[model samples]
Target: MEISKQYAERGYAVIKKLLNQDEIEKITIIVDLIYDRWLNENGDALIEHQLINMHSLTHPRYFKNNKSERIKFFELIAPEQLTDLIEKMFGKGINFHNTQLFFNPYTNTKTPYWHRDLQYSLIEDSIQAQEQNNILSLHIRIPLIAEKGIELVPGTHKRWDSELERNVRLELNGHINSEKLPGGILIELEPRDILIFNAQMIHRGNYGLNKVRKALDLCIGKQHHLLSGFLDRDILPNDDEIRCISNNQWYVLAKDIADQNFAKEIEN
Candidate 1:
């Protein structure tokens, strides 16, 4: 299939049966090990943190320990056909920006609000800024387990408007009515299947009765160099200052009013 052309026109495409059982097992093992490690270190606190910061936690660069493992795993899979698909979408000379694992446990819970991946990045400055840099935000999701998958609004990526942005924020704040946004047209998949979409698309994590849905999510930027954004700089915090190292150059991080210390700073 001509995935690049399709993705260019439609903003998303699904590649069926990309991984064999053996490859799926390898990815499953790697993800399971990481999840175990996460539980060991943080216990239930990890889930609490996720619940408290679902929208912000989507930034993979902020996750350090998982970032290293993800980078290594991506390197192992870089030469595969998946990377070829990315090359077709973004052209040649592409490198890994960041990768993440989104595990939505199968339990009766509220569905995630519709939001764009670019909103979670440092590039969320202005509508004009988003238009200039939004194409760089490409996302690929590989379902590690079968049954549960994401729900997306097809062709929504191309409609660059302020209403979508406002809806995203309102949804995050639990103020928007679900019926107002696009709801159906879910992308369900079996194990090893992959779905690649533009990061600007309206999508939400859907967790049904399956109990646990694990997906290996990866993002690639336009530049060959690693991206320097809030996740790598502000949240991580280095040397008493938020710093981002890109192309071996250090840049000071921008202050975010949402930080935990923001309230304390105001009180003082």
Candidate 2:
């Protein structure tokens, strides 16, 4: 089946062997290092917050002055193999927003509950429902380990959530967010596979399916008013850093969009 067809019908799509073992190994090394650093620094906060994932894997702070590794990280994350895929699927002008590294919580090891990504944002729910198709928020999930990955509600990206979905996702009236929704699709993925899903679709991670979970998510999106300004400039390579790096299209586009959006703020 066509990737776009699967995406349109199911609000998600999976591509097989998108990264070879060697490629996966390089990414995992850095991811592992970053996770260790994060766990050391935020051990209490993460456990206290009960958060299972950490964002901004590219943030300079994580590299601990290891400029070479950080530069390598940026390049690896934007390989043409991935960028070309995104352009083909969603058309041009997509930009890197941030990154997320997912793992089971240290104490409870429970997966996050199902919910659409954007509802937690400041954008009103009514606007999100109205402009669902016009927006292009996506989570390009790349698992570093094989596992039963995520469960998503089909076609919910194009339509509002059902009442049952609303109750479960929002944990309304005693319904837990992790409560299983009817017809949810559990996408099993291997290390080399890629799962591209609508960020606004109802979904949750499947942490219990695997003992070790280290998935890297590239938060990519086309520039939209509703989603702009959330990007951090520090994640992009500096001018000197960008020159030596190959596969910088995503960062270039991200920096350009961030500049445009911030400029608009001053102008107004």
Candidate 3:
């Protein structure tokens, strides 16, 4: 309905009461299990695995690993109730881009700079493609606790940043205080609320200090989507979580997109 239009115009939409309390309880059980693992072990191995696999450019202090754990995490998320809404927003050819489980601690409350998801190398090409084709991709963020976290500048998705904004973002290097940033819109969400935003929009988080600020950032896109540099370019066919969520139609579309990107690499 109006949610899709609002998302296009403002680059984000907040769906209140999107998940009932019962659903939230079920999801929280899984989340707590993962968090408990991190707490008990301090997740040294998980962190080590991520450091080895991740591009050097990314330096996330906290994240969730364990494929089986992630499978359970996504299993709760990929139900038709959510995918159906996403498909309606962007039409067919949807593919899972990536999943991020953020656990920003109070000690490391400083957050990254305001930036668009498009890689710097791909920015110009992405802008051109968006103008020509209306390619809309987004991050569906589900906060497990009430938090005033995400901050963004509305309509930033449709326009490049101003000189001042760019300079500020560059100088701060993702360490600036989010609330102090000019023209920032702070989005406060409750436990069961859903906040979906175009990742292309300039945004950053305000780290929560009271408790472990936790959220799930799930990226989804149409076939021609360009995403952040951190994304794994290829989705392995044997990935159990992906296969569980995807049927034949979804698999074919995802495979075609992955193949096209791979072909481009070989050609270059």
Candidate 4:
């Protein structure tokens, strides 16, 4: 069972101990630095929104005067082992879109909910199901702290939602989004493990069990019409900065897309 095959069949794959102890320690320290800043700024808002995750980890606004820290974080994220794994998953033309940091909601009362990533977007359910196989959006999760945080429905990536799933996910009929679906598997990950899952699969972040959930997700994949225009120009590296990056393929692709999108925005 190769990784690709397993991924294609199960909609997710876990690479255990992908990062060594040293790498894990460095990431944890930097992640805590970033998380503390974000939490300090958005603690109240996280409770208000019932948000369990934060995206766009490279945004310049977060760093402000601490540009060196941002660059260091970027360098840590693009290590040779991770980059090589990403290449093996999706060879060329795959862009690193954005980064997301997953943590527990500010309040313990907020339970997790199930969803495909596109369901929150403007795209309709029918359209998303029809185009499911065409898109390749993925969440490469790097757990900075060990936890059983993620629950995913296996094989859902290859098919559309069943009626029960639709009802539970959409909260239609008498069902609620938090209601557990059949075949849902809770994923337990350690500090150094990496898990790759389809962004469009039926999944949720399990809350309350762990007081601290610090998982850094490298959102990467092919740019599609359904999932384009999200790359923020300020978050991506410029021409000079990218030169110093190790395994710069993903960042280069991301910068190109960001530049193009920025130009398009200006024109419009």
Candidate 5:
């Protein structure tokens, strides 16, 4: 089957070697800078066990000054090939929904439970919002470090969980025991490999094995979908926040919705 068909059926597809070593190296530097800045600013509140944390670029201005490395990296290298594939999977135009850099640092070994992006309280109605011919959201995962990043139950995106599956999910609290469900598959990626999947898919990650597991999740959706607009509204940074990173025209649009939604609590 073709990549689009595979994604439509399985809810996920890994595109290998989508990036070269030089591109990966540059991204790694930017990721490290973001992580170090987070540590410096929030060391006291930082929880080592929660290794799958997200970060924002503080120097969007500097990065913007070097647009080829930042904005172009996302526009050309990251989503370029996936462009037609995405349109085929969802629709014609894709809107930037959310952006975040995931950090699974070394020595951290915790896994999140099996869950869908729709499970979040803020936008739990995602299923109802996704049209049969149009999807509300798609997640693009770019791995900067190699590891067993995410495991997903294939084809789970199209249906609600089975009674047994729901009960097990509730019991495990997202720490799904793959033994109980034999179909769960690990999504292992090499550096520069890309994985794009429906955000509604049943997935979990035990990131950061022996090495750090760094990835970027860029959520996008079909153009002009009301559901997409609803989800994006909750995640988009406010005008004041965007002003801080205005130099990078992309960062002005790309931002972590989780952080934006919980800005008050995160700051506190």
Candidate 6:
């Protein structure tokens, strides 16, 4: 499939019905299993109540606190057709920075704040410097259900500046109106349809009274020194133990090692 020129110029693209029914079914099954396990393990906590009230579910410490077994599973599944498309955009030898499962579970929440993913990356001290790199962080959203979908503001990625992040967050919190914000195309995504975009794009999740909406969020970037160099100078192990496992497994193991090494420095 040809990459959309519109996406190249505007910094975002959507390819509809990219995955077949079988592939979608397979992925949905795996995702459902994971979500069910997570809920079963954490059902009675105050944190669960907070999640319900927030009308969203996210593991803030997901990358930092997960077991290697789950990570391995992700790594094994990383090199599928979707990753190939990302490799086309980001070039070969890319690294998986993180993956998240976003769920808007049956609520009337308006929409999430508009912001770029780069703000949260450890590479830059501020969003301004990160933007100067022109490094594109590829985001792939695979919807698990067809009810509620995300809306993307077209061409807004090119127009985004640091100030927009603040404005968008305030707008999401009911502090201001987003009328001035650019309008986006509403995507009715089918299962496994992938929407790829740069990190700076203006986008938000629209739950719209849907009972449950889930999506797998994957972030991938090139491994060149210009981009990867900022992550930290530490060398990742390449031994059999590390290479033998899947990419997801490697992430989990890496997090465990980091936690053990930095335990005392972290405050409760």
Which candidate has the highest lDDT of all?
Answer: 4
Candidate 4 residue-wise lDDT, 10-94, digit = tens: 9999999988999888877877777778889988888899888888878777778887777777888878898888788777788
lDDT of 6 by residue, 87-190 (tens): 56656555554556766643343444454555555655345444534666566777778745666777756664435445564454454533345565566766
Candidate models: Cα lDDT each = 0.55, 0.86, 0.62, 0.87, 0.61, 0.54
Against the hidden reference, what TM-scores do the models get? Answer: 0.68, 0.94, 0.71, 0.95, 0.71, 0.66
Residue-level lDDT for 239 in candidate 1: 34
Q: Report the number of backbone clashes for model 1.
A: 1
List of clashing residue pairs for candidate 1: 106-211
User: Candidate 2 — which residues are off by over 4 angstroms?
Assistant: 109-111, 265-268
Q: Arrange candidates by TM-score, highest first: which order?
A: 4, 2, 3, 5, 1, 6
27-92: candidate 5 lDDT, tens digit per residue: 677666656766776665556445466534433533545544444334433334555556666665
Which regions of candidate 3 fall more than 4 Å away from where they truly are? 35-72, 106-112, 119-135, 172-179, 208-210, 225-252, 259-268
Clashes of 4: 0
Superposed on all Cα atoms, the candidates' RMSDs to the truth, in angstroms, are 8.4, 1.6, 5.9, 1.4, 6.5, 6.6
For model 2, residues 2-59, the per-residue Cα lDDT tens digits are: 9988888888999999888988999999999998898899999887877789998888
Give the distance in Å from residue 34's predicted Cα in candidate 3 to where it truly belongs.
4.0
Across 76-106, the per-residue lDDT of candidate 3 in tens digits comes to: 6655667777778877777766666665533
The global Cα lDDT (0 to 1) of model 2 is 0.86
Alpha-carbon shift of residue 158 in model 5 (angstroms): 0.7
Residue 15 of model 2, lDDT score: 95
Q: Model 1 TM-score?
A: 0.68
